[model samples]
Every structure is written in C-alpha cells, then in structure tokens.
Target: MDKTEILNNICYTKLVYDRINKKLKSNYSKTEIETLLFAILKETHEQDFQKIGKNFYVSNVRNNIKITINSNTYRIITVDRLIKTKK
Candidate 1:
C-alpha cells in the first residue's frame, strides 16, 4: 500500500486524537507527531505498545505526556472530510 493508504488504515478516533494533539502542542514536529499518533492507534487497537519503537520513528525518550484535552484535533481526518463545499 502507498503511504496515504497505510495512513488511512490507521483508523484514528477522537479519544486518540486528543491524546496525540496534546503531545503535538508540547515538543513534537509534524512527522514525529504523526508517528506518535499512529503508534497510539496501533497500540489501542492491539492492546499493547511493544512494536511502537520498531514501527514508529519517534524516540521514546521524549514521549512524556500527562494530561490530555480529549478534543478532536489530534486525528488527521481523511481528505474527503477536510474539503469544504463552496456555496
């Protein structure tokens, strides 16, 4: 699958997005945040965080998060959802 297809299969939810968004606001680049968010979704769906290090590019040393906003900004919405209709 292509990168976008791989990313699309990630299946991000609002809860996961909030947790990741807070991390992005702290100290993460766009790439790092995306990797972290993917890792989170993978873990939540699989019930473990074992392969995060191997699968994601973000280093474990910097992932220090405590409080989460529980908002819906972390998840990268699909292209279809992002486009706005012109009146």
Candidate 2:
C-alpha cells in the first residue's frame, strides 16, 4: 500500500490524541503519528514493543513516548510518557 493509504488505514481515537497533546505535551501532529506508525509497521523489531494482552501491544517510540495499540484493529488506544527514575 502507498504511504497515504497506509496512513489512512491506521486509526487513532480522540482520547489518544488528547493524551498525546495534553498529558504527554508532545504536540504530535497527525503527520508525525502517521510516520511513526509507518515506521512501526515497517520494522516492528526495531521498535520496543511489549504485548500486554492477547490483542493489545504497547510500543515505545522513544525513552518517554509510548503508544498503546490494538493489534487486531490497528487502532491507537492511548499515548503516554514513561517515567524515568534516576539511579
């Protein structure tokens, strides 16, 4: 599929966008999210991902940025930040 088609196929909920904007303060635009999703799909092993349930997966894009998605639907459920503890 082309990049635009691939991007259109991936979905994100309103709550997910809100969290990314407000809580995470990432201000991630749709284009940025689309690029990240494309990267995840293209090279999943390169991204840090953990299976949380039968159909749910959480991927860490960066040290702090994380995204939870439904494997079955390919829908982004939430976005949040990982808290880092100082040694």
The digit string of per-residue lDDT tens for model 1 on 1-87 reads 123343455445445444455534455555665676566444432222222222422122223322121122223432111123379
Candidate 1 error regions (>4 Å)? 1-25, 46-87
Error of 2 at 59 (Å): 4.2
lDDT of 2 by residue, 18-86 (tens): 666786666778778667656754554433565567434444545455666666666777666766768
What is the alpha-carbon lDDT of model 2 when measured against the actual structure?
A: 0.59
Q: Which ten residues in a row have the lowest lDDT in candidate 1?
A: 65-74
Model 1 residue 47 CA deviation in Å: 9.3
Model 2 poorest ten-residue lDDT run:
1-10
List residue ranges in candidate 2 displaced over 4 A.
Answer: 1-9, 40-47, 59-61
Residue 43, model 1: Cα distance from true site in angstroms: 0.8
